[model samples]
Target: MVLRAWPLEGIGEIRPGDDLAAIIVDHLTEPLEAGDVVVVTSKVVSKAAGLATAGDRDSLIDAETDRVVARRGQTRIVRTHSGLTLAAAGIDASNLEAGSVIPLPRDPDGAARDLRGRLEDLAGVRLGVIVSDTAGRAWRIGQTDIAIGASGVAPYLSFAGVEDAYGNLLAVTSPAIADEIAGTAELVAGKLDGQPVVVVRGLPAAWLDSDEGAAALIRDDDGDLFGLGARDAVLAAVSRGELPRGFPVADEGDDLLALARAGTDLSLADVTVAADGSLEVRALSEDGAPEAHVEAGALAERLRILARALRREIVIAVVSD
Candidate 1:
């Protein structure tokens, strides 16, 4: 696939009502092709969308965020107005007027669709458009540009039923093609540079006619197996301070086995099931110390992690002596 990205130089400060697509189109040396995908950073989109406002960065971040995911003193991972979980609600205080923070577009998907439609009408070519933004991964360092909005492109390529080179059936082989394209575009749209647009060509023919946008990238919450954990659920319940009418019993043995695997010195074989479905876990120290009572609630935390890792529900209870 041929991918090309260049800065739209000489274009000074993008104001609240700037026509970004026009600004980009007028600066391009070559015409956009039929199957080309145009990736634009959401920062510019947000600026044009009038989402930028003058305020303290933290205040703006707090206003835009719905919940905080992870916190480390001053750093925080928050779910933003766009339903995206990212750091600081994707707010940026740099590159704009002092005291002004650039927030993500109110509705990135709508912005992408509008831009794509307008570009197609103006350029007289069928093309895809993706609104890109940098986001951090769960277990990874550094950030990569991902598709927050998309038009005329399939967000993901599902290969679930396809066969590999070995002719083995692929069970879960979906690729987030939109995010991949966004990341590819970021290679040219450097963080420090003024480059805001990238053109990606030569994608597979099947993706050329797709109308699905980044909405396809959102995984169904119900379908997500590792959505919550025992600790998280219990903490949520504890915060409410009321037992749920019908909550699933988290499996404690599975958690114990996982913890043992994590060098906790316990195992499935070391656990026995009681009449009431509680689990009896036994552990012996290297020096042969007396067996200790491991709290079922405490053990539930370990099982919750295992359940999240396995992407399955587990039922567990601690055997009370």
Candidate 2:
């Protein structure tokens, strides 16, 4: 199907406590039509929501982070409360007056719903809405915009169980349409330009007028392959004092020591294994929170043979404090 993204121009600088719904409604070159998608940059939403803070950017990142996903010298990729894995936890310094950084929306799905309701009231037609932010990707060189919030739109178009032209059944195929719309709109909504709103047309009929929010796009740890940072995984594993399962021990050609330090999500923690395959596993607290303790015996059997207990103590010791 054909697609088009038209930038909404002439929007002035958005400010704290501004009426974003009214501002967007007033600045539209034309009224929004049914089935149209309203894509907005989170910068303006943050501005209108008064989300800018005088707090230090790093401090803000720490506050916004729910978990540390990955980190380098000065760059940290964290999962925010919004379930977005982003550098600096989706805290952005761009497009604001000096000395302020803006965190992502506290409730992006709610924000999208509010915007959608207001726009429909003003334009007298139903429409979809998406709030977007820029983020770097895993194993990708550059950054692109992704949908952080959505309303009245289907976030994904699943091809699961559908057959392709070659007639192969599709078991696992779903495109994140909300993110696609957000990225597509960014093509014309220049980051340096004042444009923050854009209207996209020609979306598939299935994705129109849906009330699904962007949170649906998040995959839980059960499905997320890169759930832990290499450093964090290593720290957790070492703290337990035994090699965790899935430690890449079977990859004979790989460097086991470096792999251990890089990080992993050890199933067990607070346990140490001896050379003779003996074990000293930590006891669980009163509530039995350390569910991993049960796996200690299984993990010991794997590590004791490989390290021979003597050579294992002196290793790269990577990961974080």
Report lDDT (CA) for all predictions.
0.70, 0.73
Clashing pairs in 1: 250-316, 251-314, 251-315, 251-316, 252-316, 255-303
lDDT of 1 at 301: 52
Candidate 2 wrong stretches, greater than 4 Å: 241-321
Candidate 2 local lDDT, 156-250, one digit each (tens): 98999999999999998998989989999999888788799999987877788777799999998679988766654544454344323221212
Those runs of model 1 whose alpha carbons end farther than 4 Å from true positions after fitting are 2-7, 224-234, 237-321
RMSD of each: 10.8, 9.3
Q: Global lDDT for candidate 2?
A: 0.73
What lDDT tens digits, residue by residue, belong to model 1 across residues 1-321?
A: 565555455566778888888987887778888988999889889888888887677777767776554444356666565667677778887788877888888888899999999999889999999999999886678889999999888899889889999999999989899999999899876788777788887887788667677877766446645333334443333233332222122333234454433423343224455576555554433434444334333344555554565455555554434
Q: Let me know the TM-score candidate 1 reaches against the reference structure.
A: 0.71
Give the Å shift of residue 48 in candidate 2. Answer: 0.6
lDDT of 2 at 293: 44
